[model samples]
Structure formats: structure tokens, C-alpha cells
Target: MLSTIATTIPRRALCVRTLPISQTRYASHGTPHYNEPSGYLFGEKPLPQGQKRKREDWELLWYYGMFGSMALAAVGLYYKPDTRYAMAFIPQLLTALIIFNPASKLGH
Candidate 1:
């Protein structure tokens, strides 16, 4: 009786294996679907006519100036112990101010 039951289960499992695939159609040559229009099909907005990009010449000058001053201060500190290492901080502080002022304007 156990042998008969095991033989019947395999036949039932084989009968359940067949199924159907759902069908979908595409345009000629089967191009993929996309939500956004392609760049070639769309026109990009031109930048505003009057507003100018700000120049960074002043900022660059400040950076290089402060760097040179700091290097000089470091050499001075090595040669003269009386000249405090703290003096080197002045140019670094000014450089921080110059760099941050323009950046702070962007937040507004």
C-alpha cells in the first residue's frame, strides 16, 4: 500500500509542471521604453542673459599671499626662539576670513 501511494504522488507532480507565459508587444524593432524624453528630442534652457559669473582672482591672490607669509614666519620661528610660533597664525586667520566670506554669501 505504501509503494502504491508513493508511485501516485510522482504522476500528480509531473501533471502540475506546465504553465503559460504572459505576452507583451513592442513597436517595430522592439525599442526599450523610457519615461523621460531623450536629450536629442528636447531643448535645454539657455543660461540667464545678464548675470555674470564672479571672478576668483582676488581670492586666489589672498591664498598665495597668506601661504608665502606663513612660510616666512615658520623660517623665522626656527632661527629666533624669541619670535613666538603664535605669530604664524595671523596670515592663516586672514586667509580663513577671505575664503569664508564669499562662501557664506551662497547660503543666502
Candidate 2:
């Protein structure tokens, strides 16, 4: 009975088959290939146009201006020996020192 049942199934009906895919002649021709080297010398990415420099030129100018004024005040006190000019030098000197300190965050 088992031998008769096995022989009853057809070989082609039990077999699995894959479907064929349709191909176009223009498909391989239109694909782009980029195997050439790009013209960059250093291999570095380009900087954005909107990016600006971190340092401010005006901050250095302000520091130097305060320093120069302080020196002038000290000289004036030496020449005139007046209490008013000497008092003026005090604030100028403090300002100059504060601006020149490395730990100060004025420029940053």
C-alpha cells in the first residue's frame, strides 16, 4: 500500500522552481561609475562659507587703549605731582592690570 501511494505522486508536481526576471537592454548602460580620484590635494573637507573666526580684533585694541591711558596718567602724576592726577592714575592702573590679567575672561 505504501509503495503504491509513493508512486502515485508525480515528480514534476512535487518539485520547486524559481521565476525568471525580465531584463532591459538599457539597464546596465545608464548606471554611473565613480572610480576616479576627486581633485582634492590634502584630502581635507572644505570649510563652510558661513563660519567666522573666533578671535575678535576689537578686544585687543581696547586692552591696548586702556594700557596706554594708564601709562600717560602715571607720567602726568610724576610731572605735576598733583593729588587729582595721582588719584586718576589709581583707577587707570587697576583697569590696566585687570585687562592684562591672563585669567580674565574679557576676550573669551
* Residue range 9-107, candidate 2, lDDT tens digits: 666556757455975566566556643556665454566899864657798899989999999999997898456657757766877877445456876
Please report the candidate that would top lDDT against the real structure.
1
What RMSD, rounded to one decimal, does every model reach?
A: 21.7, 21.6
TM-score of each: 0.24, 0.25
The per-model lDDT (C-alpha) reads: 0.73, 0.71
| Tens digit per residue, CA lDDT, model 1, 1-108 | 999999999999999977668655557455656646646433544448996756567988998899999999999978875756778877778667775343355566
lDDT of 1: 0.73
Model 1's TM-score against the true structure:
0.24
Worst 10 residues of 1 by lDDT: 38-47
Which pairs clash in the backbone of model 1? none
